[model samples]
Target: MSGSNKTDFTNPSTFILLGIPGLEASHVWISIPFCTMYAIAVLGNFTILFIVKMEPSLHGPMYYFLCMLAISDLVMSMSIVPKMLSIFWFNSREIDFNACLTQMYFIHCASAMDSGIFVAMALDRYVAICDPLRHSTILTNPVVAKIGLAVLLRSGLIALPLPFLVRQWPYCRTNIIRQPYCAHMAVVKLACADTSVSSYYGLFVLFCVMGLDVIFIIVSYIQILRDIFSLPTKDARLKTFGTCGSHLCAILAFYIPGLFSSLIYRFGQNIALHFHILIGTICLLLPTMLNPIIYGVRTKQIRDRVLRLFTHKGT
Candidate 1:
């Protein structure tokens, strides 16, 4: 091709995110529920952080891990929701090329970090239940801080190449992304050039992070269940099981939909594209919406703190 033709193939300065294909009529209605979910998620997570910070009794490994989880959810939710709401409510779908890449970086990195935080939470539970005596020594404050830093850095390193890889491609074809949020694969597909590098890196880090972390979490739970059942008394077993209610609820709410959505997106290409968009949106929002509620209701400490907050406010 000649230089003039090559020049004509230059990328668009901005990407127009077509929030949901074939569903523009319902976007105003859609924004109502989305706005509600986003507000709930952000407020709930911040509430958890506030309670954790204010309560001196919450300064343990379990709550430390909870703190990390709350922060991860906050980052993930904020990374996607504002732009998503903007698209839905105002049709402000046009995002600068660099801003879209920035969104992609934060969204994926925050998601990967959420997986690591869950792993950390699982380990915290395992230590608390299986080796109660060693929990403090093993998961000291300094050690927890290190684990948090490591989780963030791990995802940061893996997601570092995604923006550059996607950006280098020319968007000579479609400049519209299919989703409300700027997802890596969605953005990459809009590029006219080869997207193999970005695709492979995304898949590689996804499996590496999700694969190892989920396996370890399962193993930790197995050990936990075994330890619980081995206790001499039924009362002890019931008590131990009760302790896991919140975390288990969180795990199920998060991983099941998240994993299923991912699988369907990769393998169920024959399925309608709208289903993919809907499932992806649900998977991202549902866990975040439910997590704080689960912890607030199921964990006695958090529940008590919340009640006390209400009572004191009333007084």
Candidate 2:
């Protein structure tokens, strides 16, 4: 029986994607919410970019970082959702080997970039609240440009090696990935050769990027809190803290689900596969959908501008 069931493919031209293994019967129903979220994410992020671009008054360091966050959310969602919908709605599952790797690279790169942007936003808030006298000088146009460039380069370069690393290993086990989209470990687990290096490198990247960013963000906010309380008046303290409310919400929306999904994928062995896939999908899509909503509702300037635009159109 073992001999008869031997693996034949060394490196297939295409791989199959199984969208939510045990939930095959619910694929159509599942696609409904995913599609809804994807649409909202696209529209919301684009609106953010458009508003920030057109309103010169909003073109500050904080909004500049928000633009970066919006762009990353777009890239991250577009990299996965369309193909995932194809699988669920149309039953189209075949993905080219190179395409799979490319998808994996963009998904991870965008995620890393989002985390970096959050950190940038945190620092922007820190400077604005803690050292208001120099906020403008500290985060000038040139400095903001440099920071954005660093984020792009860092995320791209770190994720660039992942595909090449996975490609070096021959995949003889199977060509069917059990997730809606191509994920790093999902692909790595398919290789017939030892994947210890790939696994270790992935963990290292996670620690270096997400871990350090989390620590820095926490530290920045702690200092920000101290400075907020130091304000002489209660109204001043409330106003200062209110400025940070949207950023705090966006940070939580992005990190909590993301970290939970990552941890579950790595250690939750007893968890059902479909549940894992669902959480992972939510981890990616939820934040993309929520970031714009959080800012639109929480940030006074953005909220006013958005409402004005709609009201002007109505008139």
Candidate 3:
């Protein structure tokens, strides 16, 4: 390839996020609310992580999953909130391509971790409720550590290839991404490459990993409910379900919106692309804000621990 004939692929690598063009009107009105939500999401998740780490009583498998959830939420929020705030505050849509890839990596990694943690939480609940006697032996420290490592590996394997696929493409100058953050499929659609392969493969990965996790969770909970009902008393059943209600809520909050966005994009009546972006942003951001509080407050052990810490500090 002669130097003169070579494509000037080196145009100062920057991308403009078009953002939700329709919502651009709401930009000023939503800035404060967005910032408040971001702050609450980060702080809430971090608090859950801190409480779990400090409270010895919450050291079991249940809290372990909560800690994992907190970490994932924290990372997920951090991955996009700063850029989003910048977009709102400065009205600058520009994000460097490298930065975009970095954001996508963390977003996907955290999303995968979130799904994995929910599965682990469901299993933990199943064990505790269904086989209380063996819970200790089954969910041993070594097993917990191994599970954590597996979760990390699973998430990385699913998300790591995404950026590589995007980076290899020669994206033309129309770099304005339609969403608040860099989403894998959304960004890939812009790439000037045969994205059919990437799209099909990405959907395959999503369905295989996330679909399996969701199925396992459903099966675990069904067994758990049966075990709870088999017990002698209503109080006992309620107590068992009560322990997991928070986690169940978090799972619903996380999955439902995501699945809705996916369905809307795939099969809904013809809508503007920006509407998809808006739905995606809402689904992603709201869950990050709600998961920590839902999982943290519902678990009395964690709530008590957080209170005790604050009590001691005040003293």
Candidate 4:
């Protein structure tokens, strides 16, 4: 690429998001579902937070982690969806350089925090089921607070360098992002300078956060299942397994599509670009929408409270 073809400065003041290239004609129709999903995610997560805070019995470690997960979901969805909708509906494609980087940071940080919450949730289930005698002693209030603080610090510190790394790059190539939001790769790929450092650092962070978390979750669940099966009666086994049903649903809802979208973003060169973008979008939105619904329906305590709250309001 010649200097004549690139931007004049080392950095452009703004980047234009294309809102899923190759699907411009369907932007309006696509925004409909995206908007609906965002709305549902916001309402569902807030409802979960409110109910958890209001109910005394739900103040255990599991619900505290649930509140953290809800907060992460809200941050993740809000960081991208509003800007995405603007691009889709109003053709408001221009995002300031600083604003773009801020979006990128929040999205990745929230994702890391969400992954950590899953690990915490898994451990909570493990303690509750595998070692019921020591559950409260192990996961006391102070300990839970420390775990939450550790998660927040780890996520924020790890993601703190991303925006700075991006800002250091000379983005002279083009200012047009092909996706709906300021995805790290999408933004970094626009730089005229070498992005190998950024790419490698991103991979390092991904493995450090999500990879280790996945392994821990797998080990915890294995122990949980082993203990669950050792119970003598069939009803005992079923009851123990049922206690983990919501967490299992949440883990599946988050990790499966999230990991698939991440892999596709990195290695799916032959895949359609539009398909890739859509999958990434769904990866962020789907979990936010499904998590609260899964917990609300699967957990008896939450379900009963939700029903009672609505019934009281109707009276």
Candidate 5:
């Protein structure tokens, strides 16, 4: 079956996607849950953005980071879901080379931005904890905007070379990507060339984007723990740590699955390739969709605003 669908070396223009295997025959039915999640993801993140915008009290660094995260989540959902839905709903799993490259680039950019927002949240925590006196000064509106721009440029620069590198592949054997979306490693693995370069690039970018962020966040939290432990008053210690509880939870939800997914994809022995598609979908989609809801429930300000908005509407 694989040999029949495989591309001939002489004619390689478009890629055929197996698209979740046995489910392709039943894509329409399978797509229902995916569609529902995608819808909820959009609505949930946008609602968080709206809440942050409407509440003047949330116009600070932490909320600024939250809003940025919401925007990133929105972009992340939009990048992959529509195509994923189309693939399942309409049975069109074919993505052209240019389109595939474009998809991979934008998706990576969104992923990087999402990860960067976590770093920004860490910085906010550091300022609020380590240098309370200058928190506002350190995270001014202008500085926040500058930081956002820097994140954009940095993520773009990191993901920019990936497409060109993949384009150089001659595609001697097959163009059939087994998954619905264009994943970097999945695509690179299909290349007939020596993939050591692409693999190195992928790992390097992953370290810079996710690895370094996780390390810094851990270090920051350790310092935060030290400061909290040193506080004289019980109430002071509780209050200081209270603000970080939501962020800590958010960081865990975002990074745990991410790190596991990367490690499994890169180094795990005898792992099925299809598991990559499944795990990647879960890691990328779940956090983007759930982050806002998690924060809204965990953070008092957001909860209060949500309650007030609903109360005002009822009145």
Candidate 6:
């Protein structure tokens, strides 16, 4: 990231991830809530999976998509949270280059899978609302399997090159990754190569994968809204809108903070490093923790199943 064209071909060294550097004294305190959030995220997502599997009445496209979303959140959060907590609690900040690359790949892949599942969920709603009769036909189990595979491939393949691109470059600038994990841009910034290609390629993947998904999601909503309003009765409209509320909240939770964090990262260079880290961490973790909760509250079946599970446990 230093404005120098010369490369330093020194031996590769480990990276030190100083988790929110300025507030080292309170790292333990900061990890307290993160630990709670991580625990909740793990348990809640599994609960969703278990309920979807055990409840035969819930064996359908919507619940399958929910399962995928839960799994994606679990993957994304698990990939980053443990290392992050280690950095905060134990100061276990040293990460090897290869391991960092692998983690970065998984993180991006999981994020892409999450976004893809969101789009699929939106499409599921569209079919359910706008074409009720054909909903089951259009999103059958085979189709859902294909959708899941596509999401995984798109995310895993697109992100595969990023680490290799960084690897080819010499990182003589510094071995300190400012954020808690080995983020793509953060790692790239440490490289002493012609990084413009890698940067542009990342943008390309972002737009091609997530941007396209967002556009389809928006279009699905537009069609869904049009159909809902055109219904003959207020009850029908209310019922339909109710179905979308949980998804809407989930979408906002995923994108709003995510986009805000990205914008700040791109524009707010003048901002303090620790604050940037806080917001970035929040964007990823908050959604991971909230999605399961949102789905549980919004879907009566899930709520009821959760209660039943607890009641049986009590018995």
Off by over 4 Å in 2: 1-6
Q: Comparing candidate 1 with candidate 3, which one achieves the higher lDDT?
A: 1
Candidate order by decreasing lDDT: 2, 4, 6, 1, 5, 3
* TM values, all candidates: 0.94, 0.97, 0.92, 0.97, 0.92, 0.95
- lDDT to native, each model: 0.85, 0.92, 0.82, 0.92, 0.82, 0.88
Candidate 5: residue 265 Cα off by (Å): 1.9
Query: Between the candidate structures 4 and 6, which one is better when assessed by TM-score?
Result: 4
Off by over 4 Å in 4: 1-5
Give lDDT tens digits, candidate 1, residues 1-315: 223222445566777788888888898887787788889889999999999999999988778778878888888888888888888888898898889989889888877887888888898889999999998899999999999899889878877888888878877766778889888888888777777888888888877778898899999999999999999999999999898888889988988998899899879979888778988998988888899999999998999999999999999
Runs in model 3 deviating more than 4 A are 1-12, 272-274, 310-315
What value does the lDDT take at residue 200 in candidate 3? 78
Please give, for residues 23-81, the per-residue lDDT of candidate 5 as tens digits.
56777776776777788889888888899888899999899888888888888888888
Give model 2 RMSD, 1 decimal. Answer: 2.1
Total clashes, candidate 5?
0
Q: Please write out the lDDT profile of model 2 over residues 210-264, one tens digit for every residue.
A: 9999999999999999998888999999988999999999999999998899899
Q: How far out, in Å, is residue 100 in model 3?
A: 0.9
Between prediction 4 and prediction 6, the one with superior lDDT is 4
Lowest-scoring 10 consecutive residues by lDDT in candidate 3? 1-10
Quote the lDDT for 274 in model 2. Answer: 96
What is the Cα-based TM-score of model 5?
A: 0.92
Task: Give candidate 6's TM-score.
Answer: 0.95
The weakest ten consecutive residues by lDDT in model 5 span: 4-13
When summed lDDT is taken over every stretch of 10 residues in candidate 2, the lowest stretch is 1-10
| Local error of candidate 4 at residue 106 (angstroms) | 0.4
